[model samples]
Structures are given as C-alpha cells and as structure tokens.
Target: MTLFSREVELLQLEQDPDPGVVVFAFDLETNGMTTRCDILQIGVKGFNWSTDEGFVQEFNQYVTPTNEIPQHSSRVHHLARDEDGDLVKETDTPGNHEKLETLPIKAALTNMWEWLLKDNPPVLLVGFNNSRFDNHIILHHSKICCEPDLMDRVRSRVHFTDLRTVLSQRGEQGNLESHYNSCDGPPLELHDAISDCTAICWVLNGKAVSYDELRGRAVSLESVLQKKNKSSHPLLIGKLVTPKVAEKIGFITRENYLKFSEEELIRFLKTKGVTKISITLCVKKWRAVSYEADF
Candidate 1:
C-alpha cells in the first residue's frame, strides 16, 4: 500500500478568480534546527489577500518531542528546559497543558494534514524560509507517521512559495522584521509559530498578488543568486565538506549544517559575507530560519 492516501485535486483552478485563491502560510517551532529534529509546534494561517477577506482558517498545535530540546535551540524558541532547570517558556509544561495541548509527533502531523486538506486544498503552501526547513521536516515526519502517498498527493497539488526570496530580490537591507515593520504589520511575538505565520502572511500580502507570482520571483532570484555565487566560487556539489562549510555549497540538511564550531561559523561569515544557507539580505538563524540581521 502507498504511504499517503489523501490527495487534493486542482478542482477547476483555472476558472477561479485571484481573490478566490487560497494561500496557506505556515511556520514551525522545533526542538532543534534540523530535519531530523522533533517538531515542537506548528502554526498555519490561510487567507486571500486580493479581496482582503481575512483568514479561512488558522491552525496551531504543540507537539511533544521524543528528544530533549538542546540549549542552543531552546535559547532561540524556548521549548525545552535549560541547564538551570528552568522551563523554556513558563507555559511550556512537560506534558499536555491547558492552552497548548501536546500530542505525539505522528498524531500532530496527521492532524496538521487534515486541517490543511479541509474542504479544498491550499493553492499555495507558503512559509518565511520554508524551502529548506519546514518543508523538509514536515515531509520527513509525514513519511513515517502519515502515508507517503498522501504526502505525495498533497505535494502534487500545491505550489510552494518562500517569502524570504522576495525580500532578498529587493536588495539593500532585508529581513522579516524590517519588511513587516514597513508593511505596518503588528508587533510580532518572535519565535512563536502562529505569530511568525501571521507576520509572514501580512508581509507577503503587502507585496505579492498571489503565490504564483512569489514562486516565479523566487525561481528567478535563485537562478540569479546561484549564478553570482558560481562567478565568485567553484560549485561545491556532492563534496564531503564540513557541515558549517557545506551551507556555502547550498541547502544542506540540518544534520549536516549544524556540525561546526564557533570558529568555523565566524570564519564562514567573515569570508563569505553570508551564511552558507542564507544570503546577506536574508540572515540565517536556525536551519534556514530567517531573523533580524545587521546588513
């Protein structure tokens, strides 16, 4: 039997108006910054910006992890305890809590897919810097817990868009916060899954008309950026380089990217002027994570 069974059809998409299109933007808070890391929370918000009709649905879930959250990762999102024996966040309890009910990784993923596939499938699957992070993690876990066929079905029907690419193409100083502030978006609870999702959507709405446009822009920008990289440095494909160094090569998995020392991280930034996984315009945080940067 195939892994995933639920598949969403395009369903007369060509006839639909721009305002009728559904765009789902999501974010993930994880125990660490890798595809192999456990997902801590997921937040998704769907809306049609053309009509400004607001969200069709907003979903958020907390997932219990099988592994303990690391000190570095906890510092970023505060999902686990630190060496001082303090919980990452006061509200983040060990087990299921009142506000955020915790579920097993597989169960949470199944629910996430169900919520996403409700009524009609989202025309676009968007995230701030999802191309290299959230997408990989979701797809990785979904393969084991959910049906691979269902995951494939979902993939076949939806288009993926990364808002970070758009900001990078704009040039000068760029990051999620600056763009969000420029758009007059509300203050964000940084690192929170749902808040990040909302912030990303608002920023996206302030610019692009639809997911198709963003996808096109991301593709064009990626080509331009990669070509520029090629001009400066030889392409380092399929080489057994250090994890920190591998990011310079392009989109390494989290497992491979995190295996570096402080010196390597510093050396990479000072020399390359950009993180391996991110450009100067878009600063890399945790595994393809984009945050504020001094550009």
Candidate 2:
C-alpha cells in the first residue's frame, strides 16, 4: 500500500550530505507491449530535490531496434522517418523530430545507465508508469544485450521511484497527460521521450513542492516490480498479487492470471494441492489480481 521504498544498504549519499537527494527522471518510447518489444528512444533529466535544481546533464537518444518500427507504434510518437527507414529531423521546420542519428539498442541502454550514474552520489531512477512498462522494457533489452543483471545492478545502486504511484496515492488519476492538463501545464508531446520526460519532471516538481514531501513517500524500486516465488507452476505474469485467497475461481492463461495481496500470495502457497498461481495486471481496474490453480 505504501508508495516508496529506499534501501539503506545501497545509500551512497550519507558520506556527502550537501547536494541532497538526487532524482533522475527519464522516459522511454517503445515499439510494443510484449516482453521482447523494442525500445525506440530514451530521454533523461537529473535534478537535486532539495533545491529543485537540474544538473547540467541531460540525455536524449533514438535507438534503432532490431525490428522495424510498426505502423501503429510509429503513429503514437510521429517521429520523422524516411524511405531509408532512418529517423530524421527537419532542418527548417517546427513539429518535426530532431535529426535521427541513433544508437544501437545495447549502446543506448548502456549510455543512459552510465549518464544516470555520472554523479558521485547515485541518483534515484524515477519514471511515469515505470513499474508497469518502462522498467520491463529496459530489462528485456538489457537481457538481449547479454547484461542479464543490469537492472538488478541499478536497483542495488539507487532507489527507484514511480511517479504514477505518487499521483494515485494523492488521489489524482495516474495518466501523465491528464495531470499535465489539470495543472494547465504545457502540452505533452505524447510519445516523444524527451518531451514526455520534461513534462513528467514538471508534474512531479509541482506536486513534490519540497524534498521532504517526496522522500517521505519514496519506495525501493526493487520492491515495486514483479517478484519471484517458489511454486511448481510458472507464475509468469508481470504484476504484483494482492494478499489473500480469491472468493471465486477464474480461468488462467500463459499471458493472464489471478493475483493475491502479499498476505494472499502467502496463503495461496500454503493451500494443499495448489500447484499453480498467476498474477495479472488489470489496466482498467488499475490493480493486480491473483489467480490460483488447484491442479
């Protein structure tokens, strides 16, 4: 039920206290919704929370995915594209994506990771809907690049913050554009990573208002995403399970399943002959549901 979790064992800021908490907000544009999906671009911005100061460093890059950009995906961001299939920018026109010199998938992810850790004290990784989407995409690509442990390494280096959770906890709908519109904030660029990152920073800055306010609610990034548990069945879904036994039984699939709260997950594990369990994320319901199988 809590929003943020910080790991004290990973705290690098204790020795150097003056700069205050660091937040590195970033965004990702990807090709699709599945685990093996491609990431088209990334944008990052770093700032000091106490003084609300952004560091001189910012990162933006378009990446060439192994797969060509799908038409539906391209429609979301509207990046400049040519017959040669390269992303490009218009020389004298407005509303066109900047010139599309792009890095390879591995290079882009590595570069973004390096830039985030450039500071002496590590920066927290913050993202909009990161737990559900961005983090997984990053992880999948990291694995493809043969750096299977990259995300775990990052998690160990700094805390991860989810802007969506904070917004929802404060009773606002967790959509980035909706929040931006309500504040009369600038129009979001929709799927452009840099523009979206900037918009998120604006929204978070407006809501956080003070470092103490954010730090109090910050949670560990490792605790936010999918966790593995021992069971004969695969438990393959990506969302967290609610903690309790279900009042009713439901069908299960490779891509979908029920969920349990932390307590519920434990109880389900204890059930006799319970051989399988699945965790499902209901985007419409905005919560993870636990599905159990007594096979």
Candidate 3:
C-alpha cells in the first residue's frame, strides 16, 4: 500500500482542547540498533489534557526475545540471560524488579496494540528519537509477525511526534538526557523504557509545548516508512535526486546514476552549478543507499 500524508491538528488544552485526542508518550528498549533486533521492552504513558486527565493510561511489558540479548545491549538495558539461559534483569537495574515475567515478541506486540486501541480517541505517539529507531523496530517486527492488518490500522489511526526532532527544531538539545536535564526534569533512570516515557511527558509539560504544536510536527507511520524507503532507493529519489533533478542532471535512471564513480558524479554536478554543500549531501545519500544495496 502507498503511504498517505494528511493534516493533523491538536488543540491547545488551555485554549480549546479536544477531549477526543489522546497523547501517548511511548518508548521501546531493543536488543540492538538494527531492524532485525528484538524488542526487549515496551512502555507507554498517555494523557487527555483536554479533560485535565493525568496519566490516563499506562502500559509496560517486557518482551521475551527469540535470540540471546547481546552483552552490549544488556549492558545498556540491564536485561540479560543467566547461566541457565533464562532471561533475567540485572541487579539494581532501574525500574526493574527481581521478578520479571516476559511475553513472547508477538504476544507483547499484540497486547501493546490492543491497549493502544482500547480508547476511541485519535492517538498521538510521542517518543524520543523514535523516528530513527523504535518506530522502525516496531514496524519490522509487526511485518514479520504477520500483523500487517494491525499495522495498517495503526498507520491509518495513530500519529507520531518525534520529541527529539521537535526539540532540535526549537534549538534545544535533542537527546533525552540533555533535554530532560535542561528542563529541570526530575531524576530519571535513562534506559528504562517506562522511565523514559515519563521523562518525555515531563519535558513536554516543562517546555509548555502544546499538543497543537506537536500535531503540527506529527507524521503517520506510513509516511515515516515511505521516507525511509525513498532514502534507500538506488537513485535516492525524493531525497537527494528527485525525478526532475535526475533528468536535468542526465541521470534519468538508477543505472545512469550508478554508471558514474563518486568523483565523476561530483564533477558532473559541479559542472551543473550545484553548490558544494548540495554536492556533499548528494554523495552522502548516494553512498548510504549504495552501502545498503551491497548487503
């Protein structure tokens, strides 16, 4: 299915709030950075500020992984396998207790989706750097688990606001720890998914960022996936080389673009009066796409 882009508007709670809109701050802890990695935990905290609702809904689940959690990842999230090969929470991990019950990846995903869809209001998911990481992991696992219909439902109904992007645009630090500290947010245990979700809520409220402003920056899951796919295209279509630009540059097809070496492409673009900055970006996009293609 093609991605759809539609306008989303969230009303200010103080001015004119819409009780039908629910803003959910969510987070996911994964085994690794790649899409192939398994999600270890999912956490969410939501509110309907229109009704002065405070943390109306909360969800937290630990996902049992099919593969072993790498030491590097375990070091960060404090979830690892013991000598018996059973999943265990590391000692003194924040927000984690000694007793941990985990669900299979599919079950965790399904449960989370069910919880998110329980309410009738339109859902807006807010996360820190989710656009680059957590969102993709969710999408990837959902696809592999044969939950395309659920994912489609989510794409059509739920919206996403990348808190990191919003903060960066406002010239504030984008990383959660830095942003949280800057806003004088309460003590937060950084890697815990639920704790991170709470921190996002705190930062949003501290900054007095209205839901309307977040909605203005929100995007659909489909659009996010589409942008990601476009970036990986051999020609980097819609990213560095649009159709019109490709035609103008005598690189009308992926094959034409691939025919030139990086040096050759840079020289050609220079001849066309492309600035050095644009040329650098073009090369960077090209290399990223090409690198992905190699694998």
Candidate 4:
C-alpha cells in the first residue's frame, strides 16, 4: 500500500533575463556654443535601474580641441592650455587638485561610444538641454569624424531625453542648478562636466520626477534634428552661417531670408556689423542657393 502511493516533485527552471536599458546622464563642457566649437570635456554617469544600486559606471575625459579655448569659455569651465602648450582643467574646489589628460576628439568619442555600449543594452542619453545643444555637437562630431557606424547606432539605438524639457512639462522651472537646488540635492560644483552629470542624476532621482517618467519622455535624436531642420534656414543646416549671424540678419529660416533682395541683404549685414568677409560669404552662399533652386 505504501509503495503504491508515490510523491513527485517538479523543479522550476529559471531563465536568464535580457539586459535592461541604461539611462546615461551626460554633460559636455565645450569651448563655445557653436557646433564648430570643440568639446573640452565629456562626463557621463550611467544608472541601470535593473541592476545598479546607484550610478554603476562613470566616464570622464578631456578633449583637446584643434582650436584654442576662448578666455570667456575658460572662465566658465576653468579649462585652458597651460604655458607649455598642454591642456589643463582647473578644479572647482579651491584646495583640491586634479590632473587633466586629453584625448583627440575622435579617440575621445570612440571611447565614449564604447563605454555607452559596453553592456550591449540600449542606451538613453539624458542631459539638461541636450536636444538643442549637446546632441547636436555629438551628431556633428560623429559626422566630422566619419564614424558612420556610430552615427547609425546613435540614430537607431540611442535616444535622447532632455531633463530641462521634462522638468518644464512637470511645472518645474529654471536651469539644472535650479532644479537640483529644488530637489535639495547635494552641493553641486557647476560648470565641470562630471559635476553637472552627477547633478542631473540627482535631480532625476529626486521625488519631483521618477526615472520611469524620463524613460517615457525619451525621443530619437534624429527626429529632434529633423524637426529643427524643418524650421531652420537651409544655410544654417549647411553651416554656411552661424546662429549668431542668422539672428543678426533678422532672417531665421530660408523662407524669411528669401523675402529680402540681395541689396537689402548686404545693407542688413553692414548694419549688423557682420564682418566684410562674412557678408561676402553669406551673399555667395545665398546666390549658390538660388542657383541650386534653378535645378
């Protein structure tokens, strides 16, 4: 009777889960505002909600620009070429000192790309005003460096989340520092790329906005660029003119620029104090546009 009754046990099999996407909050300290300017430093802090207890990875690198760091920009980030022709970045903390080593833009960007894709998980790039500024610089440099693979990967796998826009939607106002202060975040060292990235992570990690909300707000960088292109003047897209020059002309988009005659264009450029060489460049670019239109 005891042998007739048998007990069977079933073992549950556990399958490994796929790697979860990472949220990489990044910041770039640049030589200037324009895409032509160089990125002095790139700081990234990655948070993997699935596995990480806090920021799991950090990447900080100094980039040596082909151009000299402008004094105005240096004043902000404390990065400059020392008397020995070596690049140096001063620390924000008065007593604390740090060594600064630089990499060429191509090497720096490649390293950054490697770091971002290390886990082979999809990445969400986040910044305070990345949609307009940071993303553009990244895309532009990627193109300049002829990194088709990086551009393709960025277009496909990497998406951008602008914390400034997200916070604005949430009814929180002001810059990154302002938002961080609102969250009662830790003491922030402004202007340094690493500090800024950490601050961004702190703000997003705060009660005001959850990480889930940031994920929901993510958008492809290509879409954002496409939208901007649609609204921008063709010359601006082609880099025939700078934004500062465009604003000075009082014609932002191609449509507005077309409304004026060549004479009016020259007059406006003169009044705006645009350099004679730049005025010639603008007029030549305008005529080239007209010629292309004829085709």
Candidate number with greatest lDDT? 3
Clashes of each: 8, 20, 0, 0
**TM-score of predicted structure 3:** 0.70
Once fitted onto the true fold, the runs of candidate 2 whose alpha carbons sit more than 4 angstroms away are 1-6, 9-19, 50-56, 89-99, 146-153, 209-225, 228-295
**Runs of candidate 1 exceeding 4 Å displacement:** 1-17, 50-53, 81-88, 91-99, 120-122, 215-295
lDDT of 4 by residue, 1-295 (tens): 1110000000011112123435788999998998768988999997654442346678999987677888899888888877665678666686343557889999998888877766554577889988888888876786677377666565546677899988888787798888788778768678889999888877766633555566666665545554455435233332233345565556565434432334445566567665442322344434533211100
User: What is candidate 4's CA lDDT for residue 37?
Assistant: 80
Mark the 10 consecutive residues where model 3 has the least summed lDDT.
1-10
What TM-score against the true fold does each predicted structure earn?
0.61, 0.64, 0.70, 0.67
Q: Please give the range of 10 consecutive residues that has the lowest summed lDDT in model 2.
A: 251-260
Cα lDDT for residue 240, candidate 1: 22
Model 3, span 255-283: residue lDDT tens: 34443334445566677776432222244
Candidate 2 per-residue lDDT over residues 1-295, each given as its tens digit = 2111224444424433245555777888877877577777888876664444344357998887567667687777765456676775444355555567898888888777766755534456677888777776775566467364555456546555678777777677758887766656655566788877777767766665344444445444334434312231223332233323232332232112232223344454456334465544343355654454433
Deviation (Å) of 44 in candidate 4: 0.9
